[model samples]
Target: MTETVAAIVAAHRAGTVSPAETVARSFARIRAHDDPAIFISLRDEKEAVAEAEALGARKDARHLPLLGVPVGVKDNIDALGLATTAACPAFSYMPSHDATAVARLRAAGAIVVGKTNLDQFATGLVGVRSPYGIPKNPLRGDLIPGGSSTGSGIAVSAGLVPLALGTDTAGSGRVPAMLNNIVGLKPSLGLISTAGLVPACRTLDCVSVFSLTVDDAMTALTAIAGPDGADPYSRNRPLSEMTPFPANLRLGVPRSGQLIFFGDKASEKAYGDTLKRWTALGATLVEFDLEPFYETARLLYEGPWVAERYLVIRNLLASSPEAIHPVTREIIIAGARLSAADTFAALYRLQALRKIAERAFAHIDAVVLPTAPTVYSTAQVLANPLELNSRLGTYTNFVNLLDLCGLALPAAMRPDGAPFGITLLAPAGHDAQLASIGRVFHADTKLPMGARGLPQAPLAPLSANVAAEEIAIAVVGAHLSGMALNGELKGFGGRLLEATSTAPDYRLYALETTPPKPGMLRVQAGSGSSIELEIWALPAAAFGKFVAAIPPPLSIGTIRLADGRGVKGFLVEAADINGARDISAFSGWRAFVAEAAAG
Candidate 1:
């Protein structure tokens, strides 16, 4: 069975395996796989073993999250021993330091194996545009490896490495994962710094993760996600730890007749099956028009954003025009022809489209779409490179353009052996929400990992309590999940920890407010009904702001739960409940609201 990041770390901690052994195993696998196009450069096995030995000697080695795990970096990312080549040899250069994301992974005790191959300058979704030969799709020899993160995807899927970093501007990260039957996590833009990354589209590019499991992908994401002083685009957004799948999850599905499978009935059927699975798992499917998102996707290439891609390779285009791949050069050279007027027109249209996309999410937790419209063979894509590549980005191209985060999960292996996958997308800071739901959905599939059919390890246990950086707040009324004002808590980056009942000593009252609300008040022990509520963890900074926004009688106070745990929550002053009605018999706000709505 292929080792997962968690399994490797646990083995290292138990003294059953050493970092050096893992690093050596990774190299051995690389040689055994024998795919020269999978990596543009590799570190000496001895050098990596030495680094692993050094890491094991550190005092905190046992506590490191990814201790001794090997990671493959996309060639576009700068790693010490590997030259930064965006698959263009003439554009390669040695960096004085590791990229910020790479450095963070190392700090977490990951060993860098080598620089993986990519689409030239990350200019194409099809992995074949690299000057290096196309990486053989681990699942099928004839299929395109899906790129520009081709090598990174193949490395993880082939079990050459447990984790690898890919960069996504327009589906480069996700398209390949679907083709390879692996997990592809495209975190919020700027969550992982681009400081040491070769820019594809400076604004839209994000470092992505490829792993055998959604949990493994998330572990890698947390280790590398953060603000960086060196990266102007990096923001101080707090990444909430994933929680148990929440009840009442509403997933957006494209309106009927809007989905495009390019005549591939197998992919279309697989997607339908995936939606049915999501329904069986208790998610509510809501139909939304996907036209605006498609428009936004078109703007990515049809607009001025191509200028960002060209900006990176302009010097190379000027000095060694022939060195760039013909397909890549053809795509990027168009950037130079776009005028400022064209750029602004697109930006303005994109902003308007973003607003439309936002409205779609107002009722749904996330939009579920096929990772790619369909798969293509290397021969087919090579013959019709540009058009075929554009079709692959059907669902993915709009994500980064609207600043949304995405999680790609392998849904099923098609009848023809092609892998079909689904992606869950949400507004930027809701990465954990996608992960929370995605982990559940992926595990339920019970599919084998990657191309080798390795049995997936058991899902790792999630933290039942809040992290030190967060504060737990109990919501009893409108702030509950699926309630009237639940978006406010979500707006503050709150994550659902658990749905539980309060200790049997709180009295629930319907408050007199414009928008109906419920407030609980403390009573003598064993004298009141047990009021139901949800506990959510909000970032400490956001918690303070959320507390300050409490109006009049509703105030933040200690509320005890059925499990004897106490948390700060909404409470009403006794004096303010004079005109309020006692709703303690209803037990919960949702129940009372449902009863009222039925009338």
Candidate 2:
């Protein structure tokens, strides 16, 4: 099999292989693998090959990021030719167009080979809730393949495709990654448009990626991430460039005696070993309270959020109750009984929990947790479905509720032959940060690519130098990644270059604006504390327009970095500081904003 996305693209571009050949090979592998449960519907090989041939004829084919790469999309997301079944036969529909995420992938030169199977309406984490047969777990025949991304995970791990798309609400994305020993990226909510997706939890769902490596997962993410007018929930969360692992990184760990392992000693030891590995990589472990996060996890199914799931298939439930899986129907039916007052009570508690989650990350770069508390056999989960499925979500259920992004990476194959993985999570828009650390950790493991035991490919190189047509600018306050007005920079086609702090000659002040923003002011050398800011590169053609749109009391100026490099950045007028509160002690706008939210 042509293993990684990078290798396949390189071969195609180098004339060693053709796009049509890659597409054909994917279908051949699918037939050879012979896993009926992996894909619910496959594209016509002749049509896909014809499309690939046309793609290769284009002059700009070499420039396409995923040129000729084969991908499998979850059944819930629409693909042009395939029927969107979402694992329920009676609820199937032929979409007029591809889902926004699928459209982006096709635009990036990827070929959609098929729609992978998933739990019915994406309602269960156990994978067996679907009417479709369960995808066989390649690692252990008796072990349950994690879901509702079961088929997507198996597709990548079985070497059928280098990349696949999955949907994540609760643990659908991350749990499957662990069970299959692949990379799963559950991106920030709305980072990828959900316009053509059948909603599981409309408010919390986002498209996810599955691949053999973190870099491969990122390649798929970069091609699809952006705001879409068709998706009201879509956000302009810019994907930043991955940087080398930073020195003195701080990682949050649950306080002692807080982890749940369901009496699986092998999994417990694997998690402990994972923590030790992080320490060896030069990270400082900071302990934090886990009760709040646990409480947030419980609210997903126990509260009104389940109503969102019910809302998606209410018509199907009313028209043909037996058409739905018994377990799925039982769970979603609870949503119908939720009252307005009950919804408000849960919403109020959720808001408070969100604040605590914000503070939880204030002192750490990212938090590491077991992707799943433990592993279960297909027989075990079948016998005790609800409890075991809920247990798998111990670390993942609260992510979307808290508006965070995550990367699930293979940690180790336990002595008992079960796969164990760890997930790195941070507030939304820190996807790049998690990737930076995750890539290094994954390479350190030197694990095989998937169940087939293909040797892991070398890490792909990312360019460190700025492009000639781009101008780099520093943003200190509202325009920092994941901040209130960060979309303004992204809207101008800006890409984050790096995150760094200013020289110890600046002060930050909170300006009294509609939505409070911070301003950075230059002072005498050594007179003030350093302030954190991100450097973003914009096409030189848009630089002038970006600068000219700046409102009064704030303007672009030359700001010096602590590393002795100077760049154009945001600064405040001296007169505006007269009535504003000095916030320089907080170091950066994000930290200050988080502290305020916590209060």
Candidate 3:
């Protein structure tokens, strides 16, 4: 019985064992396992031991959050003194610093034992394309550990670490989790900085979290996440604005006919039975056209995004092509086949498919589907590498391309004892909603954490952009639900509350200006009718920043609502009313804005 992360933390917190003991234990495990393929490099034990003592020696040592927690980082991420190979020896390099995500974790008191192996150039979904051997699935020994995050998944699933960081371009983070029976959280794109990461498909790439429990994954994510100005892709989204999932939530499932299981009867049956469980949990299952999603998925492999990979190591492939793994080299070369026109054509089609995807989400809070259509053995993945790897991405390829966040968790064991799992996908900013409902779905499955019976906590899906700290602010326009600049509220973790009318004392005005601002004036008693506005809960940490984001004329002030409750809502000074037009007759901001759009 190996100690799980929670167990180790509890022991250290209670002084039963020190951080040095934990690191020594981790080194002992690595030595006993002696799987060369599991990690590309292992850190020196003395350095880790010395660092552990220096930290634990402090009188106020408990302040460290992940204090003395040992973690494995994927080799693609640069850990100081560790070589980054991305599984290609020719491409290996030593970075002076750790990746931004890794740095944050270390700062919070997590020690990196070493860099684990990855698929060649982090290109293939199958975890075989490396000079080092593939890591076997920790759950099912004969099965392939999901790659390119293959080893990261295996290390954590094996209880080597409580957590690890993996990059998701085409389900690298999630696919491995499914095979190993763990939690893989691919947050909204741009949620984690890609600055120190070697790009997979730069635009679609996201740094993902892997843990045995959803709670652990969330804890790790909340610690490392936030905008990285260094990485152009990083977005400063809130973690507090995301609200709790309501009971009896609406879930969208692809029309059964649309699911592709790739000839795995066990997987198909496993998925179908899971849906029944979803229904039993008191939720509506909405059937959606998964064709558009499939279309977006196709673009990932067939489209120019492969060129993003080609962009990164063009020189390596051009100079020493022979050094590459045959399958990986073959796939990397495909980017050369794509022309600029082909790239633009794919982009054009993606835009059209995204519109249809919007309609898919309109009727459902989150969509449920397989993390992978099925699983494969290491030998099977090697025999027909291309086709088998492509099959693994059948359900996953669409997520980031469609600008969505996802969480992959084990559901139940397949009849063969291989793990089966599902992913819940939602729009970019709705990460919290997907997690809220996803926790329910995960809880119903009642599986053990990772591959062992560690008495896991029922997962509580973490809201990716929740603003748990801000005051709820009601805004009629510009900050209205799905309106332009609404990101301002989300930036500070503002959550949208119910939309209700204002007290009859307030009069509505559509401010006369370009881009159109709105103002509501409090009138004499009984002179004005109730107007509509949406309440947003903001995280306290983000309130000041949220206020600073508000532009001219509109300001936070006490506004009366229909229910006799007065909260902070948008108010405009009376002096701005001279040119403002009365849009009160149009009712709420939504109606006024829609009419304007139609006009």
Candidate 4:
């Protein structure tokens, strides 16, 4: 069985394994695996071992987070000594410096073992698009490994490395992880710097993480996530501490008619089993209309976003058309015909769709969907490239477009022995929240680590560091996770503590504000409901600033929790509820807004 990041770090700290020994073990596995397509280029064994040896000599080496952990870098991300081919020989170039994300990983003591393969210029969802032979799927060799993060997914799944860096544009990061039965974390756009990455769609591209477990993925994210001064899109978003999943989470699922399994009964069954597990774990499944989300997904390839892809290869497309993959080239060239009018029209449509999305999210904390509708064999995709590739993006293409963060977890194994996975998505800056839920869900399944057939390491106690320095505030309405104006909390460096409910002494009212706001007021215990609310921790210094920004009728006050604790939360004055609609029966602001949207 392959060791996990936590296990490796523990072993290193205890002096059970030296960094040089671990690096050697990784190379041994890489060679023994005999998978040429998994890595396009690898660091020299002696060079990597020497680097590890030097790290081991440092006085503070044992204190490094990822000390001695081996990692694979997607070829598209610049690694100091490797040539980034992005699986295109003609476009390969040696980089003098590491990508911002890679630099952070290295600084945390992670050793870059190699550069993995990918779809040429990251233009396809099916792994077969690469001219480099397809990386054999670790679970099922006949099945396509999913791409364009093909090799990175395979390496981690096969235990060649516990962590790997992949780039997500469309479904490159997530689809591969699902197909390979590993964890994929597509973070909020700009959360991880893309400064040294080759742009697939500059505005939409994100450096993604792949690991054997959600904890490992989160560890890598913590080490690498932050803003880079050189990257214009980099953002200084706040990351919350990992806490337990809420007791009664409202999760949205696509309506029955909206699910598209594409005739794969095994996948359909796997998803059904997953839904049952979620319900069993105390999540309230809410079915919602997915038409708007699907419509938005179509815009990714059908609209001006294709122009962004064209921008990356315009010069190459014109100078050496034959150098690019035929299918990938066909897709990029279409952008040349798009008019500026076409771009703005698509942008306008997206703005309208975003409003619909916001309304949809107001009803649930996160949306759960199959990572990919179905899996295709290499031969199957080769016969029908365009349709199969599009199908793979059914649940993924809208993520970056809508600026949401996602975490993919292995859910079940199909009757046919194929791996099946689901992704949890939320609005931007909810990366930590997704990980919190994802960790619990992944552990509940008790699935083995990737394809290694080893039990997952026991979950460690969540660090309560964020709670120590910040104050937890309960929010029930527009400030709830994924709702409108949630950005204000994020702007104050707030972190979601957990989703919980207020005491049974509170009544909720929908106040008549411009965008509408919910107000909770203390009432007689027998007359009020325990309303759903999220606890967010804000820095002590910023809490004052956050309270000062509140408008009339809403003010911070001590609110009692169901557990008998009290925290400062949003409240409305008694005078404001006179004409406001009493929505206490809905129990939470999400349900109240959902009912309004449906009507």
Best by TM-score: 1
> Quick one: how many clashes does candidate 3 have?
17
Kindly list the per-residue Cα lDDT of model 1 for residues 14-51, writing each as its tens digit. Answer: 78999999999999999999999999999999999999
Kindly give the number of clashing pairs for every candidate.
0, 0, 17, 0
Model 2, 210-247: lDDT tens digits are 99999888889999999999999999888887887888
Runs of candidate 3 exceeding 4 Å displacement: 1-4, 241-245, 458-599
Q: In model 1, where do residues sit more than 4 Å from their true spots?
A: 465-599
Task: Evaluate model 4: give its TM-score.
Answer: 0.79
For model 4, how does the per-residue alpha-carbon lDDT over 301-409 read when each residue is reduced to its tens digit? 9999999999988988889899899999989998999999999999999999988888889989999999999999999999989988999999999999899999999
Score candidate 1 by lDDT.
Answer: 0.92
All-Cα superposition RMSD per candidate: 9.4, 13.5, 13.4, 13.0
**Superior candidate under TM-score, 1 versus 4:** 1
Candidate 3 C-alpha lDDT tens digits along 80-179: 8788888888888899888899999888788899888889778877788888997777677898888889888888887777789999988898898898
Residue 32 C-alpha lDDT in model 3: 73
**Reference-based lDDT, each prediction:** 0.92, 0.92, 0.82, 0.90
Question: Which runs in model 4 stand beyond 4 Å of their true positions?
Answer: 468-599
Per-candidate TM-scores read: 0.80, 0.79, 0.77, 0.79
**Of models 1 and 4, which has the larger lDDT?**
1
**Which scores greater on lDDT, model 3 or model 4?**
4
lDDT of 1 at 492: 97
